[model samples]
Target: MKQLQAELHMAMLMITHDLGIVANMADEVVVMYHGRVMEAGSLDDIFRDPRHPYLRALMRAVPRFNMAPGERLTPIREARASTEHLISGAARPHVAHAHDGPLLTVRGLTKRFTTRRTSWFGAKPGGEVLAVDDVSLEVRRGECLGLVGESGCGKTTTAKMIMRAMRPDAGEIVFNEQGVPRDVLALEGDDLFAYRRKVQFVFQDPFSSLNPRMTAYDIISEPLVIHRIGDADERFARVKELMGLVGLDIRFLRRYPHSFSGGQRQRIGIARALALSPELLLCDEPVSALDVSVQAQVLNLLLDLQDALSLTYILISHNLAVVNYLADRIAVMCAGRIVEVASYDELFRNPVHPYTRALFAAVPDPDLDRKLDFAALMEGKASNPAAWPQPFCLDGSVKLPLLDVGDGHLVRASADADVSELRA
Candidate 1:
């Protein structure tokens, strides 16, 4: 902050998991889970008047420092079937003012991969792994929608599909191009290539994303050369400008990726993402790979870039706190499906999804008096991941219904009434 104040400049992208930093620096926040936005709003609205179930659970999960010594704090709930109603809202026109029109839209999207196995004859695959199953979402211009979930929940795969790095099995990806709705999945040849220029990605691992053999200037300029957007002189000039835009020293342009720290490399990644002046940027765990302190800087950079360039973003990560700070809306995902979606404040105050609550509970809160032993909690429950047929429904017989209780809040139902309710 001191350096930025002294330079009178800021970053282009910032990704992180900390809330304190966000409270101090962020103008908006979007909470996500499993490649979906669950809640979103301005910073004050989210923290002070959270309206979503997932957001509420997350806030409760924040460890505090002033709890009476040994009193047991409330535990977060787990995802289940009975909470299905929580996923439904009162079906109103999507007239959210914070953001307008879908910048990126996914309808009836599904991605299934056939497993490759050895056979007597050169045989085709038998079964498939359904990574993403019938997911639909809309992100408007200049809006930040966060996707949050646990590990191995297909969050990264969803991002890849949006970036066209992975193909979807079935669905429509609609985006506005020159004032017309275009099917992103069908784009090819020059159209596809051009779309790539308009929609860019900031990878999770900044160090790996940046080429070791290339100088920072080369890295930033490479996009211009490939897109054939500007002449050599213009590209060089743009490269220096990008360096400055991302809060990096122009002198560092000649330096290699390995020459800089993790946070600096991420800045380079941001500069490269901006080379095309993209309308949308897909962030895949952008801050997970950086140090805690460094994460804040990168996150701030992203926010600054969004404001300066009018960039819309789809932020993917498993960190609820981070999502709460960056997203305008959030979607909670579990087992390849979105269990709930709501504005940031709504979701934080009253999350309906059991899975969402469990996720929040998993977060260690110092303020609360709670035990931290998962094995003990699951003594009667199955301990092995594979042993459990499903992450949400541990027992095969359990079925959940999505219900909208009120104010756009949805919850999954469980057989046991206790299961349907969040653990206190």
Candidate 2:
């Protein structure tokens, strides 16, 4: 971090599967799995007061601090009942916290794609796969809302909708500012262009997101040029300033994307996003592909930028620890739906969803004293959406009708069945 020569007192925004790193780095935490949030809290709260069933499983999965050499760590279990409509309630009292208000809301958003026919198969048509299904969510001003899920759970799809990179078939995207809600998806022409300026996207791959041919200066200044925000001199000045804001040296501006390292590339991507001075930033797995050290640097930069700019961000990722540290609130997403939503501290203390529990159980423990790997115990447990067993939830049993169990904690309605039943 010192070698990068970043700015002052950098605040971290970490994302990782490793819990030990989380314990050491995160000020707060959010636990998630299978696109659903299982828990979140301060590092101590998650370690000390794990009220959610899933959380307990995660704790046990951590190799025992004192155990026989050959003994295996126990994997977390799921409920026997179907997850179609189960609702798990909070075990602790609810507490309300301050939020900056909804800056963006996605309502009834849905998208689908039909696979193109193959010539060898006589142009056989492929069925439609629903990527996003009537999903609704809101990000408060100056707030980080974490969107979590397993791979292919539509986390990236949802982020793309926010970026207008992919159009939703059915939904209303409302951008609320100063108590006024404007339908973002319905706008066109200059209105749409203006809306694009208001919302910017930061992709997961820094290597591919940038134009290889363009220098960092051109890449960052492109948005300014397209939007006609500043003249040549001012745009150049802004580019240099943004590079510095993201902890990059001014000398980097003349270099192409390939000239930098993974971490440096991401910083340039961030600088471009800031060029438009967007109000809402849609971050799609921004740190997933980087090294542990690099991840920390990028995460820290994000936190510093948020504080400095008071920006609203919708952060999408599979890593729970990252969300736990940075997000004020969280929503766990499943196949095309938001299965649970809650404040960071409250949810971590008491997770209400079964999938959420399973996800938490999947996290690897680096500091565990035991030699057993809990992930192996969890194999054949995650749900497979296609060819699922009767009353199956792609992993195990889980009913629908995800219920809001009060205090803003939402979970699958079938929260009664215990671990034994979940495995049966």
Candidate 3:
């Protein structure tokens, strides 16, 4: 695009939420919020010395490679859930203190699709699509774990299986329910209904996930109504409190989903998911679709809510930067299997697997002088399991285990691969 622009000598007006792209391509920058331009200046002037508080906050919220190991992002307007509205009755689950055990556990979880199989003259049957393959994961209590990968990498599929939104072809999902480990996959009837109240999902698309026919109030209170937990008056009060909790105004409760902006609609989704006060929140790409400034607000809101409520989140996203900002531990998936799992600092400090390194290489560096590696991206060999270098390589005859190199950091490699080789 830069080549074309230079060749044609044309002025390109590129509008996007990616600050890295803006830093790399733009000579001038314009910061806007709520249909108004807050500031406009040269790229260096705007980024290096921002005048507007909103712009400054937006930049602070973005995850940068140069940021310190355990630094937190500063959101524009921090919002926390109000726990004072907790109804002392059957509606609320018995709140328990977070223990050392995992809040959720998944083992050998696999899902496959075989409907696309076809055979000519019944000679041979097509193999099924292994959407998820022998995946195992553990979510520590009160901590955010990120499931990250490119689209079609089975990140969302794994989350769906964990939430029981879809059934897995094989494997087990276990939840530590009030200090008792329960097999989540075997749950049925009222047990399943009770489980639903314990785990809630916040979807990727705010617009599509919500029903246009329903108003914000109806959407937020739908869970409460379905469970038959609170009376009309109680539900109404809860809805109003939820609106305030998510930074939405009570006046907008009667408005339909179409009337709300992208961020507002997402707030409604978050509020709806929180209606049951679930201990686990499966947030699938919660902030990817929103604008940059709005993304900051939502990310901060999730952080604040987690701190206030002791919520455990399984945040799924393709953006490494977003995950970097929010996740305590990140699991990197490629094709259908997890390639790496490590602490936020360890993963960023040293990404061991080829697929993991490829993902890092693909991330658009915020540094204006550092250009993207189109050659590595175009080759795409690193992400292909069959083409991975050395002991990391996989083929039909070989399946490797995720061996821990050190300090709980796992990397999927062949049996012969040693820690020194991986570190090298």
Candidate 4:
């Protein structure tokens, strides 16, 4: 299109929600919200001199390669969830579980696929494949742990095991509730029900995650109905409260999922996830399928909800930018194993793991002068751990372990691997 426009001397009006594409390809931009055009100008004028507050908010929300330390994205607006029909102390202040140990812990977590059917899930075919290869991680209360990796890196598989949607072949998941530890894999009957009430999952595709036939009200209140938490009147009122909480209008409660926009549908899914008032949420690429602008809204909503409900989160995604924006700590997965774990600031500033550095290199920058380095990225050979150099290589004898170089930054490397070299 650019070539044609240059050769034929044509003017094109490009409509997109991807700010990166707009920055690279567009000569002019029109900022619109709620069916109204708020600003229109040249790309330079629009980006450099965003006069409208909405436009400024949108700019702030765009995922970027260069961000100052601890600089948070400013959401366009916040949706405050009311506590009218909620449980007692629903709106209490967030209490960090730092001193209480981890809220959830996974030890020796492993899952294998026997047949040739599931090889596409980051596994070599014609043999037993380890989809989740001896993974272990922890989540603390009121903190967001971002599980980030490339596609088919077992991020979702780990999340599924945590959610108990799929049975893991081996591993013990311990749920620590108020100083008491319960084996998650051995949960039965009422124990399972109790466990389910404490954890909920939000899926990637909002449309598929929701029942197309069910109305918004029914969808949001289904968990309540199933749990027998409240009567019809009480549930309806609760549904209304949840809808408002997610910034959805209660007037649309009678409408089906298809009638709502992508962002709205995701909000509905979030509201449904909150119906049971779960303590932890497993968000599997929740905003990946939405528009860029909408992604900002949903990310902000998640943060707002976390603060209001004191929620713990395991946000799974391939997008590092999203993870950087929301995560307190980040765990990097590569080819079904955790390669690194560290606070957001530490990981971004000084990535010790080879794969983590490669991931950062792969990220597309919106800066005009800073083009993507395809050569270095291809040479990184990030998919195959066996191809890595020296101590980072996973050859026959180079067993890797999570070694701390400095300040709780864990990187998987050979025991004898020089931590100083990796840190540098």
Winner by TM-score between candidate 3 and candidate 1: 3
Question: TM-score per candidate, in order?
Answer: 0.68, 0.71, 0.88, 0.86
Judged by lDDT relative to the true structure, which candidate is superior, 1 or 3?
A: 3
Give candidate 3's error at residue 138 in angstroms. Answer: 0.7
Query: What's the true lDDT of residue 28 in model 1?
Result: 76
Name the candidate that leads on TM-score.
Answer: 3
Best-to-worst order by TM-score is 3, 4, 2, 1
Clashes of each: 82, 35, 0, 0
After TM-score superposition, the amount by which residue 296's alpha carbon in candidate 3 deviates from its true location, in angstroms, is 0.7
Top candidate when judged by lDDT against the true structure: 3
Against the hidden true structure, what lDDT does model 4 obtain?
0.84
Report how far off residue 113 is in candidate 3 (Å).
1.5
Q: Which residue runs of candidate 4 sit more than 4 Å off their true CA positions? A: 1-16, 21-57, 68-98, 117-127, 396-398
Give the per-residue lDDT of model 3 (tens digit) for 1-424.
Answer: 8879999999999897778788878899998888999999998898778899877777786777677866777666665545444454323433547454888889999998775444566545567778998899999888899999899989888989988889999999999987889999999999999999989999999989999999999999999999997899999988888787788989997999999988889999999998988899999999988876678778877877786667899999988888988899999998889989999889988899988888877877666655566666637676678888777887874778998989999999987787876865
Candidate 4 residue lDDT tens string, 69-147: 6666665565455534433544344466567889999998999877654555764455766789889898888899999
Local lDDT at 238 for model 4: 78
Residue-level lDDT for 15 in candidate 3:
93
Candidate 4 residue pairs that clash: none
